[model samples]
Target: MAIDITLIHWIYISFILAVIGFMLFRRDTTIVCVVGILTLAATSTLSVSASITSLFNSFIFAITELLPTILVISIIVAMSKILTKSGINEVMVAPFSKIIKTPTTAFWTIGLLMMVISFFFWPSPAVALIGAVLLPVALRAGLPALGIAVAMNLFGHGIALSGDYIIQAAPKITADAAGIPVLDVVNASIPLVITMGLVTTITAYIILMRDLKKNKTYTSTSTCSSSPIEETQEGLMSERMKKILAISIPIIFVLDVVVMFTLNLQGGDATALIGGTALLILVVTTCFAHKKRGLEETTGYLIEGFQFGFKVFGPVIPIAAFFYLGDAGFYSIVGDYLPENSEGIVNDLGVALANGVPLTKEVGVITLTGVGVITGLDGSGFSGISLAGSIAQLFSTAIGASTATLTALGQVTAIWVGGGTLVPWALIPAAAICGVDPFELARKNLLPVSIGLVITTIVAMFLV
Candidate 1:
């Protein structure tokens, strides 16, 4: 049966292409999304007033749906700030510095520790924590600053943030868009994440080793002697308090994880546990560090946390609103205001594709991968994931592929690209900390990340 493609479907497709074009040109997508909302509304409703109202509602709905994730990421980032102020973040990774006696050990140790810390605290904070305490050690162990940057970028942002297993923020966003359970995305991502992580990190390590051999300037005696650990002022906390909080924080998070597994908490339940614990830790640590000013300090920290959270989400909300309209649930929110029996533009398009398009699994995987990569070019990594999820949901139904596997593939690719490994601007934190150019760091990351992405994509074929 041939499915009829409506005007709305073509409009949606056009907007998608416009978004990609905007991203490619390195332009802001917020305006494009805003325009898309207007166009979608105008096409779906005859009344101009109704179209405007529907547009506003879509933004509101997207915010309501994604608020929890924003909150979780904000609280976790705030907690990291508290830890940094208390010097606990530095203390947390201090022990690992002792294990870095050689270049090989330094690379693996720094990379693995970065991966672990990034999982819990996020790469933004983890970069500061690892860089302040461990970078010097890795440098002293004969790794170049560029090499250290690669390790942090690949492991922290590329692998940890891409998978985002511990925090579940990335999976939550993708899962919500796909209209599937978050655990489905989380579970499906495991194998693909591992494959990408190993391939990229190992490839990077080999490249670094070959470069080191070529340039004797990176020898242990020469490189180790020059780099010294940079010091920063610790906030108003006693040494004992710092030690206590450092120990307590990790233990608390680990226990949260164990409890999650014990109680079989998967999606929002798991996220709530983590977010709530972070809030508690933030309070406790603030009180201990600023006893006289605890009340005022806590408020300040909360404000700062919320500020950072909203700042990150500011660009994301409008983009997400445009994509959310593609989902059936969100569409209903706006659809009710439209003409009778108006359907989701994207979902309707999906139905058409499923019936009319000649989509095999191979074609489905490649097209989705390309879409994910293009969406990621916006450099937010996150902005594109919801689109990927929506597209994955559409294509999976069209071709009889595993929705979870497809969604996971899209999630991984979008994140790895925009999450920092492939994008120069996104590579700033890791690059800056190591005193290397962001573009140079991105260049080093290109081969390893490219190889890893290809292998992971191939693995995704089987999963799909």
Candidate 2:
């Protein structure tokens, strides 16, 4: 009845702690992750050459496993580039812009639009997508740049990314580690995300309103002396064509969703459908926008997108590879070295804890939330959540709790903390776009986000 905990298990856990410590200290974990893999490999194979080969193989495996996520992100970025260049983004947001008459309207309008766009294009690009065009208008309408930054950060990077329902990247990673279906995590996260989003955004808006009432002279940050908007350049596409693409593009993506539901597609199949749609959009948009040199321009846009994708994902891969060793990567990257009757290293640990300790759902909920916040200190939100997922699986099994709820809790906490709201560095894109100091944005977000996390964690206890 006892599960055997192997040396590999200890190594995996030890390296995980080291990775967390590094993240807490705000150090890069790539080296720590690589060394962890090599140590696991060397322990398993006991041969220097094979161990090194295993290390290389582990990287290959990580890349292979993450390729679909990478591909979809790259393709989406490619599509966004074409959309931005062709001025179609302006067309897309025109109707929404007309409704922003005051600071209240500005906050809700920009925040909601950012959340929607972020679901599809992701927050980093979505910040650029809506920020530049709307920043000056919001500033003129009396919303401070800091308020704008907070809205985008909380709505787009915090709310949209935490749920990640459309793209499913966050859910996919956490679900993989929790050893559950992606839909399970997504389904469980809906309520928690809504709660966190509502609590955080409303709290921030109220605090911001009070701050404004007290300091009616409160104005945009110093950097807002000039607009972030670029001068409009004449493009290859006509205004009529831009407007057409703007209307048609959303319809195409909407149809992708309809088709997904109709065909019962999910997971990788769903992601593939979305990726294919983005790729087609990129090609067609580039072709229409570039006209004669459409072929070359399309390639050029894709290359840029790939570059951005890899740059963003590069730090994530090594860390992800290390966590993969806890479960699926154990046999392939190391060896069939798990003890007999052992489910996996992480699972074994969970079993051992369950047998030895009196764990409860409350303990599990708090632990996952704590781990999520600690891991999020690194500011690269995605880099640390693999650890969250692994830990969620470990804790949930021990507590006899729902892995999906625990995993979703961890996923949301990590993203809210590091995905651009609480972390200064992660908040830079939105901050810079709105001409506010990143630290100020993070400061403004601290209270609201902390409160949200507390409430969300309490809600998660019941869910678990």
Candidate 3:
């Protein structure tokens, strides 16, 4: 059966190109996505009223699909805020400061610690966890703030997030779009993720070392001031409570992982376990921190958590909605007035292109990698991951490729780019904390990350 490339498909491709162009100029794609959705609906329905309804339906569909990720992230962030306020976050990483005795040690130690912590709590909160404590230690040991930022960025956002082995948020989105089990994406990403992490981090370390040799006198004192850690006075009772929660939180998450493996839990089951544990920890921590005001404070924490989740997801909604139309399962959300037996625009286009154009394995590899990179231009890292997954499924089906490996390849590329390693704006948290220029940090990361991406892509071709 030959797949016909329709005008609607062309429009979708055009809008995607436009979005990529805007992102290259460092512009937000929210409006472009909105226009794309309206255009898609209008073309498919040929009725203004139907198009308006479709728009709303698309948003609803996106939210429904992504609610789990948003919620888990929100809850974790809220828990981090509580920990920070109660001084447990500082205590958690305080021991790491002792191990940074030299510049080389500081670089690898801080980076490794960030990777481990970020894998569990996420890079955003992990930044907060390590920034104040370990950063000064790294700086004191002769590693420049920019170097520290590179280590943190590469390890936390690039490595931990790209794989997302523990949290599984990235894998969930990609697997759902690929129509595979989350464990498939998770298991498949392990090698690619390791390759990217090692190559990028090592390259970055070499660059930092070269810079350091050029300017031996460039110590932490010359470029930046040591930020003093804040002290919070508390009764012995409260201090003990902090110690207990600090120890308890990490253990609980670790046990959750253990239970997950023991029970053969994956996908929503694993996600539910993590979410439930986070909520429980949040409640316990909130009560311990606010004994007198526990009831009122718990409500406030939940509200804040929900707010943070929605806020972060706000831009992602429209972007995901536009991409969701590329999946056949989501076609109904876009509009029901299309021709009988209508297929997704991207899927149909993939089939048409595959049949009309002879695609070698190399070409398939490059196309998927390019699409992942293009989607990552939005700087959200996550918004385009699902698109990559969906496109991976289409490409794999069209060419008889390894679907899991290709999907993992796309997921890793999208995240490493948008997850904050290559994107300047996305690197703000680490940059701001380390007091380095975000652009400088991004520039420092460019070569290493690019090299890593190329190597990983080639490796992906073999896997597929």
Candidate 4:
């Protein structure tokens, strides 16, 4: 049967054009989002006028669906920012310096801290924490700023985000696409996660060690926030807030981990647990921050947090809407009840690829990993994850590869590339904070991360 362009196809095509145009022109992300919204609205209504109206409606819907996650992330960021302003961030990390006395130790400590913190609070907040508190210590300990940045990038954004054991957001997306239980995806993903973690960490250590051997003990006096340790300060929060954060955050996360294991909860359940905890914390902390003007200050902080979240994630909305058009779950929202056989973009793409591509589990893993790396060129780690999940569905049948494994591999590759290691633009934040050339930081990461990814892919193939 000859496939004809339907309203859905036209909408999808418009989204594609917007994406391509955004990429080529490097346009403001808001512009890209508007374009995508307009395209989807126009197609679903089958009229330009309706499309314009739908554009407004789609934004409203997208914002609504995204509100919870956005609020959760915003609150976390706001709390961290508040902690920094109050000096608890410095105090929180200060204790570690006692045990971490050497450059090597600084590297490992930064990497380890990033992994643990990111596993709970997530990479964006983790980055802020590391950059604020640990960067100075790593620098003084004789670890180069670039090295510290690489370690943070690899452990936090790459490894932690890929595994996402606690947050579970990544797995949830892939699990839905696979039409499988989230627990099934979670169970299947463990081996791949371990494999990638081991390979990436080991490769990173070796590279750092090699660099150390070539030069004698070298220490830096220049101060940068990207290093991992900072001078301790006081008066940020009441000693009470400090104590609460010190005791509360870890306890909540640990309890969450235990509950997940005990109940065998996975994916969205896990994400909900973490996000819910964050919400609770946000409320408590905001309340604490302003006991006098309780509602006003709390609202202000929340607004500030949401503003940051939108700024950070806004461009992503349109991109996600475009990609969501592919998944059946999201198609109804974007497509106006388009039939399965009619013109679903994601389904059509997956079906076509499944038919045309010769894929095995091993090939699928590598292909998705490569796709991740390619997408990472755009310099936002999570940006490629949705597309990666969609593509992973294509190979699941031929390769018998679980969607989780494929998604993990994609997450692993994309994060390393875009999370501030290989991509200069993404590395800029770390570089600027650490006072190093962004390109140099990127080049420094290329070898270690690439090697790690290759090894991790092989490991994922066998394990998955």
Best model number under lDDT:
2
**Candidate 4: C-alpha lDDT:** 0.61
Model 3 worst lDDT window (10 residues): 220-229
State the C-alpha lDDT per candidate.
0.73, 0.75, 0.73, 0.61
Point out the worst 10-residue segment of candidate 1 by lDDT: 219-228
Q: Please give, for residues 1-464, the per-residue lDDT of candidate 4 as tens digits.
A: 22344566556656655654654443444566567666655556568877666565555655565565455456555555555555565556666678667878987888888889778756655554466456655666778776777778778767787667776876776567555566766676667667766776677777777878897432322122222222344543688677767666656666876776687664345556665666676567656655666577667766766666665445445454444444442444544456545434543443343345467776677677766775565455555666666677667765676666776666667667765566544544445445454445555666677677787788877766
List the lowest-lDDT window of 10 residues for candidate 4.
221-230
Most TM-score-accurate candidate: 3
Model 1 per-residue lDDT tens digits across residues 350-432: 33444444588987777667666756654557866886788789888878999998899889998898788876556655665
Error of 2 at 54 (Å): 1.8
User: Model 2: runs farther than 4 Å from truth?
Assistant: 99-232, 359-464
Candidate 1, residue 394: CA error in Å? 14
TM-scores for every predicted model: 0.62, 0.64, 0.65, 0.58
**How would you encode candidate 3's per-residue C-alpha lDDT over 218-246 as one tens digit per residue?**
32211213222223435423667777766
lDDT by residue for model 2 (1-464), tens: 48877787788778978976776555677799889988988887888998888888888877787676567666666676677667886787576557877889999999999898778656765665466357656776888878888999999989998999887889999999889999999999999999999999999999989988888554433232232333334766898998898888778766865776678665457667777877988899888888889999999988976775565456656776776666556778777877878655654664465445446899778877776775565465675577678777877777689999998998999888767787655665676556454445666788999999999999998888
Model 2 — which ten-residue stretch has the worst lDDT?
Answer: 220-229
**Which whole-number lDDT from 0 to 100 does residue 235 have in model 2?**
62
